[model samples]
Target: MWSGEESSRLYALRRFVDVYPTITKPDRHVRFNEKMWTTTFVLIIYFAMTNVMLFGLSGQALDLFSGFRSIMAGASGTIMHLGIGPIVTGSIIMQLFAGAKI
Candidate 1:
């Protein structure tokens, strides 16, 4: 059992998190064409990024996590190589720490 009060140690962080900028939810319904266009644009950008290799990376550079590439949805030696992994990892770590009250 715990009270809802913020811990003194985390009071500053809580305030900072609250004031952080974030994308606001749309107020009105989005049109189908708008949604399709947005999806198509994003897909095109993603494909383009996947094809663009990292600058100065050797052609023979070995990928240690080649087996997990499909699962991670990332390209080897590209800018998006660690896409979503760090974000998801941080989220999970925060969740675990919060659950343990650490």
Candidate 2:
């Protein structure tokens, strides 16, 4: 358990996180069909984006992250080439700061 002082120190961090723009949670339970539909729609969009090659780029363009493509879930020459990178980086920095109390 955190002492009062520690909790107070973290309060500001918590508030900052709360105000950050993010997807809001539903107030009520979501039905299975609704969940399935949402998942399916998102998957369709992801697949479509993966197949979309960047226009005007050469077919033999060098792929800097070819080996890490699967881990990044990004298409090397597509719109999502930086997939989840910013988000993950932000999360990592936040975690490090919180851990180090900085």
Candidate 3:
């Protein structure tokens, strides 16, 4: 039998990924988008240097990016990792409808 906390956690996770396909584009890039810019080499070096700094700065940035790694799989995984929670997703639906004045 599942504990109360476990059941709620499962339900909460399910709700966060519950979004419709909006009329707008969901994302513009994938991971390792080195081709998106003309300055690929420069961006590579910049990313590398940032990694060096992040590795030396107690690694909080790395931890954050590790959370974002799920986004590489696309939006469902992204929402799951974010744990944006149930009420927030419901609120966003209301927000979009309000914006549309519907």
Candidate 4:
């Protein structure tokens, strides 16, 4: 049905693919049990902290001075992102060593 209005669409096509005749608890917009919610919450907290730390009260302070400080601090963000690089690298290395790929 959506031909050229894809760019103007609100939600993605995949979400609209499965439709329920009636709205109930399971058919609600929000899925509370999913890991996406948890990841989104964590991202929000991380960005909030970064904003507060980087820009005290004035959002305009996100300029050269504050930017320099943030860069110098080597912001690996929270522990999860910090460890993710190493973990992914190690897993990839292990997989290659195990001859799992060409």
Best TM-score among the predictions, by candidate number? 2
lDDT of 2: 0.82
Task: Return the TM-score for each candidate structure.
Answer: 0.52, 0.53, 0.19, 0.23
Encode model 1's per-residue lDDT on 37-72: one tens digit a residue. 999999988887777887899858988878777875
- What are the Cα lDDT values of the candidates? 0.81, 0.82, 0.53, 0.55
| Worst-scoring 10-residue span by lDDT in model 3 | 72-81
Model 3 Cα RMSD, 1 decimal? 15.0
| Per-residue C-alpha lDDT of model 2 across residues 6-94, encoded as one tens digit per residue | 66766668868967899979999999999999999999888877778878877588988888878857677876775778789999999
User: RMSD, each candidate, Å?
Assistant: 13.6, 11.9, 15.0, 11.8
Candidate 4 or 1, higher TM-score: 1
Task: Give candidate 4's TM-score.
Answer: 0.23
lDDT of 4 by residue, 1-102 (tens): 557756655656667657746555656565657768889998787665443433233434334444544654433333322335787898889999889655
Q: Worst 10-residue stretch by lDDT in candidate 2? A: 3-12
Query: How many backbone overlaps does candidate 1 show?
Result: 0
Candidates 2 and 3 compared: the better one by lDDT is 2
After superposition, the stretches of candidate 2 with alpha carbons farther than 4 Å from their true spots are 1-25, 82-102
What's the number of clashes in each of the models? Answer: 0, 0, 0, 0
Better of 2 and 4 by lDDT: 2
Count of backbone collisions in candidate 4: 0
Error of 1 at 8 (Å): 32
